[model samples]
Target: MAEHPAYPVGLRLTGRRVVVLGGGQVAQRRLPALIAAGADVLLVSPEATPSVEAMADAGEITWARRRYADGDLADAWYALIATSDPEANAAASAEAERHRVWCVRSDDADAATAWTPATGHSEGVTIAVLTTHAKGRDPRHTAAVRDAVVEGLRDGTLVAPHHRTRTPGVALVGGGPGDPDLITVRGRRLLAEADVVIADRLGPRDLLAELPPHVEVIDAAKIPYGRYMAQEAINNALIEHAKQGKSVVRLKGGDPYVFGRGMEELQALAEAGIPCTVVPGVSSSVSVPGAAGIPVTHRGVAHEFTVVSGHVAPDDERSLVDWPALARLTGTLVILMGVDKIGKIAETLVAHGKSPDTPVALVQEGTTAAQRRVDATLATVAEAVRTHEVRPPAVIVVGEVVTVGPREPE
Candidate 1:
């Protein structure tokens, strides 16, 4: 091992060029920030998930749909290898070393020079939690503990350095779920540095308390049944802020890409030549139900699961989902935005093969302190919701999984 010298305290990646050599979730999670930090990111991987592919398709990031080569690192200021294969990541790490540029290996195994510390961002001010999670122990567990400590600290600390220096153009955020406390450590840091926050309406307002008292807030949400600002407008605003050299937060509800339009907005920023990054949030569709005493999947109840949207047109029969196939699948189905269409949806399910007696539940504002849940069967769900006057911002769990809930403590 070689001795590593201390580098500058604030050598950020803004306006630099970074090469990311992977296409799955890790790169997807990190790519936005690289762009947000004003880095011209070039992605080199054999495959890309839908979101990553979309970013590439939109030309937000340069794409090389092949394995990493020595020259792939050319003109690169930093390199990140996020491939599932450890060997490829090691190779990329080696290439970065030869180039004497910074590198972060997502695998974080042997031979990598640097690690992606637990970090958070809001605006351009970032707070990073550095820990010696050095090998052998669980990385995720260490991150969780670190984040707990970071969250407890108020936002006032970032002010001294922030006012003296230009805000770094990178933010590493952690998007908490409906419960604000679930946020990661680094997520807390970035929120403290933010000058403005463009957040989802559901991202636990209490969590925003960490921001400095004067931070600007914008509610650009597309919550079901509730009015929402158009996505184009939100993207334009984020880009404009960054172009004005202002740090901004594109805060999102869940992991941002779990049907949160994160990719769309991110692409818009890249196309507009604005900088960006992403902090993952726990998805409420699953976490919410689990927290509400309803298991969306269970042994014998359901062995398979699929999450689909209920926001489609009412009678666009041709574009509607295959009701018969879904009914025959014998698994759990989680429908987002299905509160208003329960009766017809249930009828469609039964008309195919789902039994009219199948168990169902409507979970509203799940995982929040204000959560409410009502249980019934396919035959009774429509009436149950109507009688209770349940609104949107709800998730419907179908199949026998809804039958497994708290037993009143015996």
Candidate 2:
């Protein structure tokens, strides 16, 4: 009999040696996440892609430029197969089980002990999105569905799961962006009723403060960066907590599903026969830019905009940013992780066709108390940020929308 695959109550992957059997965009897209969850990643690929290469060079993960061998799984605690070749992934999975390592095949849902869910995290919440048939699909297909979820998260249309139709006691809550005050009134109310808060580190400290002192709080870090928990641990925690007739708030930040991996968690709960609901909040993708007062799309200034992670799924030989399209188009271009790569981004845009004199702005800590604004032309923002020491969590806005601001004093 096959093991019934359901969403684990909650998940953690902290400090676990996990092998990624491929180095394409999927591995590139999922590696940072696994690392962020505190996994010690060992990337197995014949050749490194740009993203994977950068990570390996940074010493974030060890790169083995060879095929997956049974020896690689010897001490690995958890494994995920993300190779472009499905046959190779299957071979790796069999090796993983032989080593007794818990594993999930990125391209095949049923090939492993679990499926890595699409996730989103913010101030006080981490949500997982996964499919009921996660084991039945190709990893790329699984990731495609996850990407659709990512788009919903990007658009801010994705809400937390709400099965009020089936479960009366369950409540959905949004923990807000990296800040606690950003949470909504309804989210706070629902959180207050939660007996078990299945939360991740990103959940705001203040929001956690709102709970009664003794309320059970589960920290599913899922990586070695801090607490050591696994995805399975998180799933189990939610199920066990809720099964005890406890009101559980799977506290996730930034609208839960927005890269929060929320859908997986919700589906897991439902599959496990748990009652649930989802309350939405301001996702950082839009809110972060808007908070910085940078509109993703303005009436005339920006007609269309693309919001993508600066760190995840980066470009291959060249930038993933469609420079020519963005340059020729008349609209706003908001780059999230373009901060570190700001100079490169500007350089790319200028080389593509955008004027070197194009106006730009770097808003750091937007909508918060410590907001900073730096305005300059595409030629200057690179130096401007360096002179000012602008940091991450900052956003880059391009096009005429930036020029609309008042002139700097002479």
* Best candidate according to TM-score: 1
Candidate 1: 10-residue stretch with minimal lDDT: 1-10
- Top candidate, metric lDDT: 1
TM-score of 2: 0.49
Alpha-carbon RMSD to native, per candidate: 12.8, 20.1
TM-score of 1: 0.59
* TM-scores for every predicted model: 0.59, 0.49
lDDT (Cα atoms) of all candidates against the true structure: 0.72, 0.70
Candidate 2 stretches with Cα past 4 Å from truth are 1-172, 178-181, 200-204, 219-236, 316-324, 405-410
Worst window of 10 by summed lDDT in candidate 2: 161-170
Over the stretch 1-410, how does candidate 1's per-residue lDDT look in tens digits? Answer: 32443232444777678899989999888888777777788899999999999988887898989987777887888888888876777777777888887777767644566666656644443666544435444567657855654444433343433456565343424465567766554565567667777787767677676677788877765323224357777776777677777778777665677768788887887788766777777777788778777777787777888887777634556546766688788888888878888888888888888899998878888777777888889999989998988887888888777777782221
Instruction: Please provide, for model 2 over 1-410, each residue's C-alpha lDDT reduced to its tens digit, 9 standing for 90 to 100.
Output: 14354655564779878888888877888888888888888888898789789999999999999877768888888887887777788777888778778787766665677667666653345556565654354545556766666544433335453445424334446676567777775677566655777776655556676577667776767422335246656666777777777787887766777656677778878898887788887776666666655666767666776655455323445545566666676667777756877786777678778899888887766556666778888899889989989997676777776655453332
56 Cα displacement, candidate 2 (Å): 70
